[model samples]
Target: MEESEELQSILSYLPLLMRSSSLFWPSQAVETLRELGGGRVDSGYLLFQAISHLRNALSLSSEPLSPSTALGYALFFDEVMSGEESRKWFREVVPVLGNLLLRLPSLLETHYQNPHNSMRTATALRLLDSQLPGIIFLSQELIAALLGCSFFCLFPVKDRYVNHLPVINFDELFASLYEDYNQKQENKIWCIIHYFQRISSNMPKGIVSFERKVLHLKNDYTHISCPDANFWSTSTVPLCRVEVHNSGLIEDQSSDAVEVDFANKYLGGGALGRGCVQEEIRFMVSPELIAGMLFLPAMADNEAIEIVGVERFSSYTGYASSFRFSGDYVDEREVDDLGRRKTRIVAIDALCSPGMRQYRTNFLLREINKAFCGFLYQCKYQLYQKKLQDNGCSSALFDAATSTSMETSEGKFSDHKTTNSQNDYHSMDQGNNIGVATGNWGCGAFGGDPEVKTIIQWLAASQALRPFISYYTFGLEALQSLDEVAHWILSQRWTVGDLWNMLVEYSTSRSKGETNVGFLHWLLPSIYGHDEVIQTQLHCVSCSETDKRVVGMEAYLCGLLAHQHRYGLVDYSNYWMLCVALRPFISYYTFGLEALQSLDEVAHWILSQRWTVGDLWNMLVEYSTSRSKGETNVGFLHWLLPSIYGHGTGMDFSNLA
Candidate 1:
């Protein structure tokens, strides 16, 4: 029964196998073939070992062909091999495998149509770094050749941290086959193999462009802390038209717009690993997108990478763990003068907080900045290129084929090596007024709230001057109020600053324990003009029931503070206000609210440590928030506060008043 089940799984992959040439072998079989290649150089021993192994395996079995032999037969047989004739045809398939193996090196070195493949680099492909705004243009033929290298596992292993590049080889994908043979991996393999077959039969003459965009924050300050930054606050841009569809998908529904890849910092994420989510699935269907991993480094917080003109080759069903390759898909998008498809993909990774910690104001700013960096169309590179050409320099002076440095009064360009050995491919369109096609970015395993992420993208697109945004919710019922919220915001004619300020206010309230309602429901209070809690019921707890109030963290702190205030336990509600202000810190301490029951207790603790009331509160808030990050639980305050309180463990606290 087990042997039969295994055979059935192999049978399932046969149709896609026949449609695509058998040269795209499964990873397990590919790894076996790699061993035959005898390291990087194929000295004819590869063909010898493969043929001898098949010959020996065939002699042993007349009924069931060995796995390697079956893969070899898959290369030649247009029809399914069945019955007695399968055994007779095994010998003929062996030489076909040898012929392909022999031709593999030359095929990758030079395309049949182009005699001199100048794009094929003699050394490793150049890496794109975060220091400079850079673009790489590659002919579709070059991408096909590089992908062929990946299929054969020819690229060397790279450490992402040291090299700042993602895994470009197919070893990991193929290695997964033997490690754990599963349906998802099989589906992924099908999509990639089918892409190779399509291109091998009819190579695209067009090009694809990959460019990195960086938003330089002023004074070297990071993200939200740069108060002088006016990227959002200065923008009076109004929200654009948003079409929220719960039933459709981003890639299919917004085919005409720039598609969002909910990417990892390391571009493809688990696309080469065990992951099969949004970014991974997209990479599988449009395998050319994977070529970005060959050169682009992990994205920095302020950076985004955009790839224009890569064609999608396959359709898919399901998502994440349940994902499956549906079948071959024919891309019908229009091609431009560059022979490029009119498709654009911008990859932006969001802050990954798998808990309520994501509700913090700082994280909100990070996400907004990252999205804006991607949506913004103009870059200093384009501006400098135009400036140089307008000065009567030959257009070819700055042609992508040469190693040129661009400097402007704004700033000097950081040095970047050309990605292609021959010519840097240019993007077909700048998409200045193009809308964005995105939905629930960072909402998956990253733990971002979809409601929050939707508004974040909207604010970004608006600031970038996009005309419209098509949001695909993938049928999440939590987002049924999405259309309602979008229309209401649009009806008010709120500018980018207006919506951004609202998000900042919402995050502040959430951090203070004032409200736990979803952003959509939170907006309803203003929409309907009522104080009633919209989505959830919040019950006030008395002092004694603080820990058992069915609420947590901030609520628990709120309850304890309110109870202490209601009773005349402290001389000043002002002091309790101070405690409430310091709630984030006091609540995270070892004794919880019980430690500083009243303002006097806090004052006394400070007095005991010889600190002024101002100094005490400031240090506590700064230390806790900084140390705790945005996490709800900072653990016993002793771990963090002791480091702050003692200055050093060697100091003697016994000398304090």
Candidate 2:
């Protein structure tokens, strides 16, 4: 029988169905009606009638229905799902839904339940916002319920008040199945479906909290103390430990560390839309993280959001376009003091520079401050204490947060000391010891330079007192020198300030149009030093690019002499010696075969001009082709003088090559 018809027909026989052994009814439904029996049985019958009427109304609607309504769950089980597979899946999990809705009044502790208490108002089940730093602590059951609401597209569209928040409904995800129908989007839906299935069968008993951290800063650059040359250039703190991995992912490999979400300023990015990269993929596996989007607004430059105790319910392979939902995953992370998982995910957006502007000093400072704002210990510790107290535990029960010195492969270093003593939360704490697990932030579609970004994040982590950094390169070829540069800095025992100075110097050079050299090459003096060796390497790299038209012993002699002159190894002062130098090319490669053509005139012209290797070769080509092309009879010096100066610099060949 249809769910609405079954519900309606059974209401009149509630007393009979209650005693009939053959009738099969959900126990929660039976208990619900029983609770309101006696004088309230009529009220219970009216409740079921209203639910049936709502279900019939939803059944007729051609558009999507919001899951927040009680009948929406029925619509999900009936019309939305299809095929024997969904039916079979529904049969196994329908009781959980029935019980959930029957007890929705208690599960959903809305703000209206108690208007007098501010703490309750803040913690109530509602949309999180950007006004002030707010946190929502939810039980796993409540999270599943919210996810159900999101799954059915029950959340209202972004209106004036909610426009700041990202789209929390699954309408876009569902629409894609009919509009484009690709496996990537399909896999995302599968992941979310599997999460509901898993939670419905064996609901976990842990709590999760999402807190947004905002650090107010002055708009005036002159007044702001951060990113100051003196402060950054004088920090005594050494760099934390850094380990780069060519393989693996940030979410799976660095679960113990504070995982960074390469987020869009709008928290979830295109997670509900088409974006399936770092931030989107993270949301799919741990769908509970999506709950933050319902309340959080587009992040400000000085703000970040940290989600603690979110359980990862699905595991997957591939990234972005290649992403696929692999299979179910059981979250085994241990619970914290408040019966919450210990997993912490911090969302910090990098500056989006679709062009070369990201390399500027101002954007660099913005990224550094953004990372610092996310890494502050206060975000986790202060909110943690509040959560503990809200759970009816004493804040004093939690020990004083403390931070110790960091130990690197080189040796131990003192804890990071901040110059901004005015900020009390800048003080060290043990929780600050969590390393940051990050890859190239802002480099993918955002166009940030990975090498510079790696160092920026490192400096921020050091200032925030993180002990180590698990840096994932994701196989970017640009970061090939990351290990070498990191090792050199450690070997030299350079402090954060030293690196900051180097970065500033590099940025200055870049702004003045001197970016031929990359950041890593600029930082490592030894690599860019020895002009001769660099020139030689450049030539070797472009060896195939040599003009094939010019060949034989004359070409060899020209190359030899050019190499000699480039490194300041050889010099020919007079025309006689210069003729001797050109003797090989004149005898072997010239078409006119002018072996004894008294090249002294041409040689003296070459000598007087002090021609480089390229000029000499082009002069040789002119002399040899004089008879062959017949135009050479127009006086070799006539047209050659103007063209000879074109190849003035031997080093210019390296650029061409």
TM-score of each: 0.59, 0.62
TM-score of 1: 0.59
1-657 per-residue lDDT for model 1 (tens digits):
122222232222111121222223344444544454333323223432443443333231232222333232232132232433333323333333333444443443343234223334221123566745666666776677667556544444423447567776665675564456577876787787667667645777887877777777554322112222354554555676788888877778533578999999999998977899899999999999988887788998888998888998999999876888888898888886656788889999998774676677667777887888887665323433445456655444323212221111111223333343322233224433457899889997888888888888988876665567889998887788888778866765666776787777676777788887777766544332223432243321111111122221121122122244333322222233233222332222223365433443433344455443334344445557766786535333343344444445532344322
Candidate models: Cα lDDT each: 0.58, 0.58
What TM-score does candidate 2 reach?
A: 0.62
What is candidate 2's lDDT per residue for 1-657, written digit by digit as tens? 122322332223121122332323345334543332222322212433433332333332343333333333333334455656455554554445445544443454341243223232244444445645556677777677656546534344425133566777676665555556567877777788788788877987777777676665644321222345465666656677788888788877643578899999888898887778899999999998887776677888778888888899998998777899898888887776656777878899998874566667777778887887777665333433344466674333222111222543111212334333322222322244467888998888888888888989988877665677889999988787788778766765556777776787777767777554567766653333334223322111011123432232121222112211123321122222223122223212222334323233344555555545444555556566775777645444434443333534322223211
> How far does residue 552 in candidate 1 sit from its true spot (Å)?
34
